[model samples]
Target chain A: MAFDYDKYLRPGKLPHIWCPGCGHGIAMKGLIRAIDACGLEKNNTAIVSGIGCASRLPGYVDFNTLHTAHGRAAAFATGVKMAKPEMNVIVVGGDGDGTAIGGNHFIHACRRNIDMTYVIFNNSIYGMTGGQFSPCTPTGAKASTTVYGNPDPTFDISKLAIGAGATFVARTTAFHATQIDKLIAEGIKHKGMAVIEVLDDCPTTYGRRNKFRSVVDMMKRLKDIAVPVAAASKMTAEQLEGKVLTGVLYKEEKPEYTQQYAKVIAKAQGA
Target chain B: MSSPRVEVIERYCKGCSICVEFCPTKVLEMDAFLVKVAKPEACIACMQCELRCPDFAIKVFKD
Candidate 1:
């Protein structure tokens, strides 16, 4: 059976505003499939996003979407979760939006272990804002701002999330379509905060500057560098240097922040 | 028929050819503007085209 992409998307938003070969579409589809697989009610699900190309995703999806300020998707999502704990809130943003500008909020959200899912569309560079070098841009990669090369190292988003106390963390590229969907579903089902880093492609800005022959070439590159987490376990550190470990990298059951806060309130009120 | 039906939303497809490249069974081909089902019988219902399409322009269904 074919999954109805149109049903979840807003009418007339078809032929999305993304470039011809952008990988954000694949990530969006994975998210929609996850939401469907989780049996989440559209009315009760809230999709929040910060400013960026990936942030534009909320506008296309049919749900209670909040296109919040730049780099503040997690902050807005945090408020939403507290105000309506029953609603499922998911925050979406790009590498620059999430890690660069919203870095503090992101780590705090993970540290709190709030019941929400954060999907970072890490395309290496900031695609929407004219392809500037972002925190996740690999060292020596070229961007509009880094014409010579990006001097700094890239941040491992999944590892950073785990370090910040995210209970569930996973990484997958747009090339691994099925894995993206499966990991997203599992992340949403997890009781505590979950972070799913999607290494998406931006052919227009990032690819052009980075010298990827085409979007297809970039996709092949992503597929080539990805090693399943299980297989990666046996490989030596040297062998896994540049490879991405895709799958649920870290997950542990813990007391969710909102639920714990509610318990505190209940005790104070004696209710 | 047990064969699959491949539909390409012409308005959405920008002729990126990602779908064509990923379709393992060679069931799809690029037209002047968009993708089309060239060999529906060989589709195998794999849905690689639908999943790999960056534009969400293609859909494969067993019909």
Candidate 2:
């Protein structure tokens, strides 16, 4: 039997604004499946995002959604989690929105160890904002702003989340369809802050500037460069060079912020 | 009827060709920027096209 995705999708929202070959839709499906797998009720879950191509996702899903300003999804999602600790809060945004503009908020959210899931659609460029080079854009890659090739260094988002004390961090690409949901489901099931960075493609803006002939070419490139975490350990450094690691990269247990805050409130009340 | 049902929701399809290109059994084909069931008998119902579709325009149902 086919998966009944329509159950979670908001009616009359089909035909999303993403381009024909864009991978954001793929990520959206994975998210829907993850939410279903976790058995989350639509009313009890909140999907939050900031401005970007990926941020538009919350509008299409049937959930308590917050489409906040650019670089503020994490901050808003943190607030949502703090106020409604029982609600399953999930944050979705693009690489630029999550890392570049929202870097401060992003790191702080991870540091707090809030019980929420943050899914970063790392397309490596600001697709909605005219192909501008982003912090996750690989050096030497071409973007609208980087006509001569991106000279700026890239921010490995998974590593940043892990460093900021997120309990769970995972990375996967759009080409690996099945793994996306599995990792997301795991992240949602995990106790503290979980960050799942999905390396999707922006064929219209990033691919055209970078000389990718077609969407298939871009997907094939993503397929070629990804190496699973278990396989990466056995491969030589030379063989692993230029390859992105997928699967759960980091995970740890810690005190969650909302729970700690509740304790503080209780102590203040002398209860 | 013998193999499986491959449904293409034309209203939602953007005709990206990702499904036709990824179909392992070559059971699908493009017709004027929309997907059509070209060879229904060849469909193994693997759901690759359905899973990879960026648009929710395709589905494969097997009983």
Candidate 3:
């Protein structure tokens, strides 16, 4: 069947709030395609988002959406999924929202292995809050808050998620549209906690401050810096310097939080 | 070579008119807050309208 994106898009909201040349739209399209590919019922889906440019996504899609306070999407989504185990819960937020202020929740969510998908739109900067420094902002990158350049190293979200016990973890860039769609689709279908970090561009704040000539230049940088895991495995650590790995970094199945909790409750009741 | 055609789903259009003002090619026109493809043929497939639309109401499909 031909893909019909309009069916999932909310009408009367035609123009989005993202700036021109921003990568959020690219990520959103990939997500929509993934949902379509998974054949998920619209009514069965619930998207939760925290404050950020990326968090604004749930408001645009025609689905059960919860726009929560800054850096709290995971906590809110946890409650939602636990309350309705049958609903397909997905969390959408940016680097600052998911990894900075919400860092504690992010790790707990991964460790809990909840049945949900978390899509981190990592544009590096806090795009929605006027381009502040975020936990994922690259070292030496400039932001509104980091006028002289960021001094701290950025968190490798994929590695962090895997180490924290996420059952599925992947990384992709908006430049690689097709691959992103596939990754998001797989994350949604995974029975346990899944995290997909999408490297995106924030042309207005990130690009302008970082000396990126244009949006295309920023995308090119992502493409040039990203390395496939298979290819990286063949290379030495020295050879992998300054390169980020894209594709499925890790996947392992374990009991999900909600199901395990239910079993515990059932056993206690019986006893 | 033909350019991609942009379709605006009016129902989803919040009528912010961001597309109408942002279209570098002047491809969009506003009518009572709703945007119409005034110059569909002129679209360069830059996807500015599609990307910037907060509502995701506009789609640009390559012909």
Cα RMSDs of all predictions? 1.2, 1.0, 5.2
By summed lDDT, the worst window of 10 consecutive residues in model 2 chain A runs over: A1-10
- Estimate every model's Cα lDDT from 0 to 1: 0.91, 0.93, 0.87
TM-score of 1: 0.97
Model 1 C-alpha lDDT per residue in residues A1-271, reported as the tens digit of each score: 4688788989998888899878898999999999999999999999999999999999999999999899999999999999999999999999999999999999999999999999999998888889899999999999999899999988989989999999999999999998888999999999999999999898999888878898889999999999999999899999998899988899899999999999999999999
lDDT of 1 at B48: 83
lDDT of 3 by residue, B3-59 (tens): 787888776676655567668999998788678889888888877677556456788
Which scores better on DockQ, 1 or 3? 1
TM-score of chain B of 1: 0.87
Off by over 4 Å in 3: B1-63
TM-score of chain B of 2: 0.92
Among residues 3 or more apart in sequence or in different chains, the pairs in candidate 1 whose N, CA or C atoms overlap within 3 Å are none
Cα lDDT tens digits for candidate 2, B1-63: 467888999999988888888998899898998888899889898999999999998888895
Question: Order the candidates by TM-score, highest first — what do you get?
Answer: 2, 1, 3
True contacts kept of 3: 0.11
Winner by TM-score between candidate 3 and candidate 1: 1
